[model samples]
Target chain A: MSLSDQELKHLARLARIHVEENELNALKDQLGRVFKLIDALQAVDTKGIEPLSHSLSLSQPLREDKVTEIDSRESYQAIAPQVEKGLYIVPKVIE
Target chain B: MDISSLSVKKIKQLIDSKALSAFELAGLYLQRIEKLNPELNAFITVDADKTLAQAKQLDQAIWQGESRPLMGVPLAHKDIFCAKGWLTTCGSKMLANFVAPYDAHVVEAFNRSGTITLGKTNMDEFAMGSSNETSYFGAVKNPWNLGKVPGGSSGGSAAAVAARLAPLATATDTGGSIRQPAALCGVSGLKPTYGNVSRYGMIAYASSLDQGGLMAVSAEDIAYGMNSLVGHDERDSTSVKRAEEDFTSQLNNPLKGLRIGLPEEFFKEGVDTDVAQAVEQAIQELEKLGAVRVPLKLPNTSLSVPVYYVLAPAEASSNLSRFDGVRYGHRTKDYRNLIELYEKTRAEGFGAEVKRRILTGTYVLSRGYYDAYYLQAQRVRRLILQDYLNAFEHCDVILGPSTPSVAFGFNEKTSDPVSMYLSDIFTISVNLAGLPGLSIPVGFGREHLPVGLQLIGPHFAEAKLLNVAHQYQLVSDWHQQLPAGIAQV
Candidate 1:
């Protein structure tokens, strides 16, 4: 199963990665080999088996509705690339 | 004195008897790291002043008559875990400058038990590669052979423990990361049941399959480390809430009448001849100690590598989406729009293997292929788990070679992705089944590198798995053998 250049670009866009033009052939080749391994799963007859999402059956534990965390905006924002007035500064998506 | 060969238990005894001060012990390990780490590339970060300060505080507490279980013991935290006031790089350029404001649950628990932090060990970038070659910091070399690659993404942790840079180190396994590296570097490693250890603040790889575990010189040392490492954390909902267990409590359990399952598929053609022979010899030793071997078949075991690639990548694609350069980690300095910011930051941040997984993950979970790839892999995952459920009914524990072959030289399998993925074939099924698995040095394989024997148990049976491994270590000297030239360090 070989991935076309158009399909490879679509995957990179969906994954939010910038794939260089030179890197495209190598990436396509690597993915082709990986897909060959993954394609083996298609042959297995899993007609009635339940898809196991997690290995153990665990329910999300509930906590009381009270606020549990102390405010640490300053500590958290200190590591952000761009922050102003305790708010993260991202590129203007609205504009 | 040459305390590098001492186990965690012996270190604690020396500290308790006042023969060694906590501050002095910290200095001894720091000097070793200074001398050997330059060549081994084992440690990514080592903070001498902070480590000595913590050691000094522990000495004061001990002087004031306070007691701690693992007092003054030095440990290395894998770079994937978030250690407060330390750079938690996760071996990726994205997190290269990220200083964690909080400690991971494992780090917190270890710190509370009075284990002084030696540093964060290097790892495969985002714990993705089978060999340590993917690390941005540089590949960690196997202590046994300088030209060979240490199995990864916990390669640095395994190498550190093997070189005796630190007596014990913490590592995580998403698909045999801990076990493979431990096997190649000649140490004991335990990957607990999926929910047995808390994942809070542990950098996500594949959430369902990723689990935090330990690495040390001996199985008995691992038991001592486990006493301080396991606990339920409300922070991680998947952290199993259970009664406290003293993992060291059962080390003396005899192997008399023990049922060890030897799966027919594990000993078949793919495994190297030497690895299989060493594991077979180790199992024979167990039989001599009164263990009965039961032959069994996990027919679906062959499909584990394919199933893991699909499921793990799917989960990782979703988990790693958080690294978009907005709140924390590396951000692009040159970007015009929001979308370009995400793409370019990640493009520069992640290495080839991580990007490969992210892209593969995106493809499988995408609109048209989701049902064919993701769902099918999950369904097959159940069949794999069911195989283990049936096998355990006939045997108390399953034994096999931890890896197909001993550690390979660098670039040997890195050029081909599938070949690298197949090296983890023997160990991935346990993660899929959420069972506890252990890798202990049984003997040497080809090239005179270490071969590890894996013991798999039912869910939350870490105590049993460690007990089984301890029984072997009691009769074997493989775990005690150090890298030839490093013994004098």
Candidate 2:
């Protein structure tokens, strides 16, 4: 689980977070240390045990296919960094 | 008497009896915040205009003969919960400018109960840090000693209540965020069973483990407040559908023949001597109140920190993915493309601790490491939960020190991640097991700072935990003891 600088950069990219050269060494060391702690989970034999995604053993409840929420697009989009004509403005995706 | 010295229940009674107007009490709280927030760094934002307007409306309703138990009692919210039109920074640059457009279910619940929102309290960046130092706003100083940290990410809430900036505060617990801070700051906080409190509009850190709770002066006050907090919300699919029960109904339950399990693991070498003594003395008082202390073993206790670090961060990584330069959070000032925008925005927005966690989570959940770390942690989490279930068979509730030590000095554990992670050694297991746990000011440790006694209970046992804490509080004055400048100020 020891993350090299390259591996750390890969993870940062995968997580969609930009990492500068100065910050990479620190994050690489810290994330590696955390992973080492997490490595303790490996010693326990878990052959038959079911992994729990949620604490409750209850089955997930399904809801009816109905529209329960009102559209508040204007309020929701008001805080976006860049918006124009009721549409969020981002860098051009296609040439 | 100064309104600052009164408890939430007492304030409610006076407001109901017309002895005090909600407006005046709100003004007193506002004044206290203005006076104390600079030293304590508890409240990140306190809008006097918004607070007084809400109080005036509540006063108007009183004139119209409408009253509620929590009516007009000003309360602070952890910056994590979204309250429409308030700055909802989860102690990060990411949401520093993001004012929530809608209310979290918890906020709406308090709003429904007529409670006044004083402002948002400081917390760790996305509820990640054990010490409050990780907050973007600044570290919350413990009121007991200004140099010591109020534990986080609910640090601000705990410090606010301890300093009497507000009578109570709403906090969320994920890996001991609520209880740890409450313990350090010497107040009472409860983390209700997972799925009990609705998570809608609560900024998610670890979806599976985060549970909203409250920090107040007493378990009775939290219990009184809990009735409004725990409700089924369709919006949050994880919300459990359970019959409404009064969390305070059994506050006077006699502790006679109650089995209080003391897990040998919790009292081991890692715990400070002073903390152990305070907890033992509190357990002795419980014995006097008819509780029979029982020795028990939760063998998998040591695995809690490792398992929680894996799972919580895994969930955090996935959950935080939504914060990419889009919808309502901080976006980088310069970016050439959409992908660049996403990366630069997140890197700039998140703090170092948060970025470290996101990196940790991404590493663990990545294609190669998923089964080894993520799956293994989940399996171990089940074992941790089973250990508690087994212990509960021999005892009514398990009791131990809420934190391994009292509030440590600032910058003490910051450099070492493992050291900081161990701060949550006692409280993380409860979230892992999906059970309810509470931290109460059992006694003071070094330098007269608070040491909390954690009471862990089975799933959906909030009422019993509250009852146990209430009975202990009735026999003791620790929960009543406030930091030096807080009392009758």
Candidate 3:
């Protein structure tokens, strides 16, 4: 139920959050406690029980696959951190 | 007139009778926020000119003989719902500067119902924590006891309604956000059956469990608010399509042969004595009103917190991946690569509780642990829901203490995450079952702070829950008791 510093580092990388060396130990301790609580679920016999994905067991409702939205790129891009010529500018991916 | 004490219904009557204009009513609430918000930290964003303009427009409509259900009543929006042209922060540093270009479905519905926006209330960072302490803006103080924390992530909304800053505030419950804070701050809150309200523009935290609801001075006001909030939305796939509901239709229904479920697990060892006494007395009052109490058992109730932590975080980790440094919200100033940009922005933007959950979610859903944690929790979730399904066959509604105890002082449970999570023990199961639950002030608990009684109803049974809560409010004046200094204001 406890997370090692190396595991915590890996988790932060996977989750896309940066954790400092000092914060890692404290976070590990707290997360370890949360995991201890979650560990209790392992004891419950859920064999053959369907994993309830939705509370009411609702199947995805469908509609005709047609454009339902008005194009509002300018309105949406106005809030982006970096946008140029109506396109989002992220760090270069091409070599 | 003591405008602060008026309910949504009373506010409507005043405006309708020409005793007050919508513009004047909005001004009264705005003035109260200006006076009281400094100490309570209940409001994160308040634009007086904008609010008054909307009110003035409504007044013009009234003058032109046009009327809507809740036309002039002022309401607070939990920062979680996006309000077009308003800064919708969701109580996170991540969204601190994000001005929404569109309104959430609930926000649009409220506007369509003719309510004037008062302001956006504060909340926990991304609705992650039980106490308002995790909010990036600041923690909201309980109206009843300024020193104590307001149970949250909907703490500010609850505190605002309790302090009479707004008669009603839109709130959401992923776990117990709405009910816990309402219980702590001494107001009425209702979390309808999941998918009852659209989640189109609500900042998602645990999509399956998140539900939009209301906080108000009384259950009747909550019913009034609900009338405007429920409807199907094509945008939210999970939004249930049903016959249009009149949420207030059953408010006057007598409890002559009503069956009230008393779950033994909820009343067992851990609940504080004062809360127990208050809940017991409230139950007696319901019995006197002709309700028959049925003893019930929900053995899986003990596992709710554990199951919630696993499932909620797993969903949160996936939902929050959208917060990369690109489209909206806070972005890192220094980053060399796309991955660095993602890591740095999230690291800088999310608070500790948010980060903790993301990390926990990542771990639980990681390669080897997904089945052991995530899948197992989902199966257990069914068992938890099954417990309620069984109980409902024997009883019409389930009643219990809303929280284990009254509001605790700031920092009392903040340092320990599990203790903070346990505060939501009684309320989380209701969310897992997709059932409508309500919290109403029943009596005072420790330090003479307010205690709340929780009522759980079957799926889509919001009318029954509100009817029971409104009946209790009829016999008791607990919901009417204002915070000492606040009443004088």
Candidate 4:
């Protein structure tokens, strides 16, 4: 499948990347090549096969519901690029 | 003593015998980092003071006769792991200044084992590129040849261990990130069965495929690290709670009755002739040691690259959404609205390769195209997994060249991303199948570059994988061959 220039731009926007006009053509070409390579999957008949999500078929172990507090919050917030009043600060969304 | 060249086992012995203090070893590694890291670009942050303090505390514990399994062994972690107080950038500009508040589960496990933290090693931005070129900090030069690329996302860790900068370094694999570079750099790297190591603190690449592993001088060291890293963790939903087995116990065992499957697809067209020669020689050595080469077919092997591209990016696009400018990473200096801020911040934070992946991922996962792309990729992934199960029925382990070729010259495949992606053709299927796979230095390729032979085992079969790799290392001197300057150091 070919990606239109508009579709590529929309993807870049959604991905939060700035793709220059020149680079878009290169990306388009690369994406096309990659998609073409992946298209080989279409030939395989997977009608009866179960699509595996995790590698193992093990069930999640059940445990009693419990809550414990580990006070590493102060230490954890210490590395944030920006923090304010014990909260990770971001530009106002509602305002 | 130059402790950098010592194996993890030897380091443990020294620490236990009181011949070397953990503090001394940590100091020596810190000194090496100071001296060699400038040229290698192997580290993003070197927490010298913190490391020294931890080593001192471990030394005190050793004095009290408190013995831990990996006590006093100095090791470095890939920057992708979140270590409290250390910058955990995953080699991306978006998280460049992001300091992790808590340690990843792997980091906690190492800390519990009293392993000294040397520092955080460099990697490709968000673990995207095969070469370290995609790192936002800068490209990591191969310790073997400065002009060549160190196989990457875990390139810095592999190069660091190769340069004797550290005895052990933590790494991760999604699509050949751990094993490919390990092979190219002539070291040992293992990606345990998925869920073997908890992904709690590892920054997500493709959540389904990403797994924590290690890069060391030998498979034995990988086994030791695996023993410590693997086990069920409640915090990580995907972690498997399997019975813990000693991964290194079978290192001395002969491979006489071992069935080693050699897939024809891996040796088919697209594999470099030089790499094939090295792998063939390694296989010959294994055969001499009693391994019977059985022909196996992973019929869907050719489709691995395409399937992985779709799935890895689809997951990456979603995982990376957390990196929007407003939350915990680089933010745009000026923006009129929230949307613009998000765009500007992400654009500035992520590098070219990362941006390309995110865009591609978003496109694939978008509305109206999910079935055509994302869902189809998942189905293909199952077919790939089935191919491995079918092979395992006939053979105990599968063997192949880790990459199509050894370490290429810097910027060799950068212009052609498709060619670069093909480098992972041999390694991606292991992840697809959720099986344990490892890369060990088998021999040298063109220009004396390292060639890695990949060993793939069935699910939760890390012990066997380690045993086979360790047995190979015993009879071969390839793992002992260090890069020129690394040996001198």
Candidate 5:
């Protein structure tokens, strides 16, 4: 159940985290132990068991087709890292 | 007399009787927070101005002849809940400067009932850790002994209530976050059934497992909060549509012929003898109250830790992905590209324990491991729930130790993640079962630290659990025992 450095980096990328060189081995060791612990679940025979997604049996409740919220763009945008004219400013991804 | 010593009901009664004003009561708690919070580090944010304003509003309402169950009672909220105009950090560096623009459903419920906000208590980063040590704000000390860790991520709330800084505080349990701390700090906490309380605006740790609850001196206090806290919200789709219940109304339900199932698995290996003895004595007290003990077995108990780690983190990976640099919370000052911006902001923002979980979550839910780990854990979760249902056929409630041991000092289990995960062994199965579980201070354990006796009930059976807890509380003095230093404060 040992995770390779390459796999750790792959996980870090998928997780949107940058694993520094020094932190990689430590992260690998810690995650390896957790996976080992998780291995205990493998012994159970869950052949026909239905996966429980949520505790409740209800479907997602739908609301009326109307906007119920008051406009609060100013308040929300006030906390954004970078904003201009109420638009969130992020790095340009495409030309 | 300090108002912090009174019960939630007592406080409301005095306010109703004109013996105390909401403003004055709020002032007393605020002064205590100002004086003692430096040593305890329980509160992350306490706004005297806003709290006083809330109390003044309640004062005006009282003057206008309005009466609410929680009126004029001062309380703290876990940092995990969003309250507009207050810093809701969730004990992480990421959201340290994040002032919520809205109130969570639980916060709104309290506000509607006229509860004055004392402050937001500290928690583990995004409610991820068992020990409160992982908070970016630094660890919260157990009020009983300064060197020990308060069980977390609701440690701040537990500590505050234990020290009588506030009468009660709002808490949430993903995997025993509420109950574990309640046990460690000698208070009562209840994690209601999934969907019993709306999760709207409660910062999600694991969307499927996280349920908001309360920590207080007694089950009666919890019922007082539950009256306002429970309701179906269209905003939160999972909010149960069940009929309303007066949780306090069932406090005196006779336990003459009640059935209490003792889950043999909960007291198996790894539980400290002292903790088990304390739990045994507490249950024996229930037996004296005429509860017939029924031995039950939840065979898949050991798998709960592994199952929860897989499922909770998988949900968290999806939930926390929204915390990219662009929106609210911390952002990277230096990054060349959008990908780098996302990576670095999160890398710097989240603490170690949160990153570990996010990474673990990402790993299990990643393309190849999905079926083997994530789906398997979900299947195991169902089996675990089935275990509780099967056990409940023979009994009305289950009793066990809330934690394996009492509070441990800082750095005791920090080096190994699995050891830390094992602390919630006895309590985790309840969350996986989606049952209502509560922790009540039963007696003192080794090191003179408090031990909690856990009582779990069928889903949405909060009133039953509360009634059982209240019956025990009526005869026990453990919940009434505050940390020695609290009296001087």
Candidate 6:
């Protein structure tokens, strides 16, 4: 399965990445090889086979709803590359 | 006393005997870290003051007659685990600055046991690559041969233990991050059954397959760490609620009458003859211990690489989406809009391999192709898991080479990600099956690089796996072999 430059760009956008013009051709080629490898799964007969999302057959264990808060804002914010007013600050999201 | 060289069992013994204070042990390891970590590049962060403070508190508690299993044992955690007041980067610039507000369940467990936190070890960025080359931090050099790559995503932890920077360290494996590196570095590592250890505080790579594990110089030390870390946690919905078994208790158990499965696919071509020879010798040693080798089949083995690439990356793409630069982590300073900010930040923050995976994952998980790729991969995943179940029906355990070859030189497979991914070919199937797998040093390969033999057991069969590895270690001197420079330091 060959990947078009447009599809590659779409995937890059969905993944929040920017592909350079020079790298696009290489990525397209690499993605094609990977997709070709993935094509082997097409031959497997999965009729009536349940998709295995997790290894365990067990159901999710529910916990009782409770309100709790632990304060580590000072500790957590200490590691941020940038922080302001006890909040993690990013480049201004609003123009 | 070079505390870093001591096994976890010996460290505990000294603590219990009151011969060495926890503070003193922590100080020894800190000094060792000061001495060797620069050369090895095994640790991302080393909080000597904080670790010593924790050690002093444990010492005071011991003076008051308070007892704990891992009290004062100096151990480091992989950067993937969130430790309060410590940066948990998961070796990715995406979360490079994210200090966890709360401890991961494994971190909390170690804290509760009063274990001294030496620091955070390095790893591949977001656990994506086989070699530590993909780390946001510079790649960790294998202590044995400085030019070679340390087996990775858990490369730092493995190298730390190998270099004697820390006695034991925590790691996580989605595929072979723990075992493969541990093998290459000639240390022992165990990837417990999925959900065997809580993943609450671990930075997610692949939710279903990622498991917290340990890498140490010996199987006994891995067992000791596992004993404290493995248990059900309410915070982790997937944590299993099984009776806590003492992993070290079976260390001395006889392997007589045990049936070990040797899968034919594992011994096929593409396996390094040196690695196959070492594993074969290890198997022979186990045979001398009265264990019988039985041929087993996992006919769908080749599918693991393709299946894991689809599923793990799919989960990773979703898991990594949380690092949008808005909450925490790297953000672009010059962007006209939020969308552009997200794009540039992610592009800048993530390494090449990580970006590749996210793109592959998003492509497969996209709207129109979901069934053709994601759903089909999931079905193939089940078939792979079933192969393990069927093998277990006839054998007690499975043995194989943890990696196809020993540690390759730096930049060896960097350009070829496909071949690098195949390095974990033997190890990924166990993750897919959710089975417990352990890698034990068997012998050295070319250039005296270490080779490891993998032992896989049924789900929640850590005790048995440890037993098999420990029994093998008794007769073989492989685990006793240390990298040359470590002893001098």
DockQ of each: 0.90, 0.85, 0.90, 0.60, 0.86, 0.59
For model 6, residues B401-481, the per-residue Cα lDDT tens digits are: 999999998898987778788899999999998989999999999999999999999998898899888877777778877
Q: By the lDDT metric, which is better: model 2 or model 6? A: 2
Cα RMSD (Å) per model?
0.8, 1.0, 0.8, 1.8, 0.9, 1.9
Please report the candidate that would top DockQ against the real structure.
1
Per-candidate TM-score against the hidden true structure: 0.99, 0.99, 0.99, 0.96, 0.99, 0.96
Clash pairs (backbone) in predicted model 3: none
Give the range where candidate 5 chain B is weakest over 10 consecutive residues by summed lDDT.
B1-10
DockQ of candidate 5 relative to the true structure: 0.86
lDDT of 6 at B357: 87
lDDT of 1 by residue, B134-153 (tens): 99999999999998999999
Docking class for candidate 2? high
Which parts of model 4 are misplaced by more than 4 Å?
A18-23, A71-95
Residue pairs of candidate 2 with colliding backbone atoms? none
Model 6 / residue B266 / CA error / Å? 0.6
- Cα error, residue B107 of model 1, in Å, equals 0.4
lDDT of 4: 0.87
Q: Native contacts retained per candidate? A: 0.93, 0.88, 0.92, 0.64, 0.82, 0.60
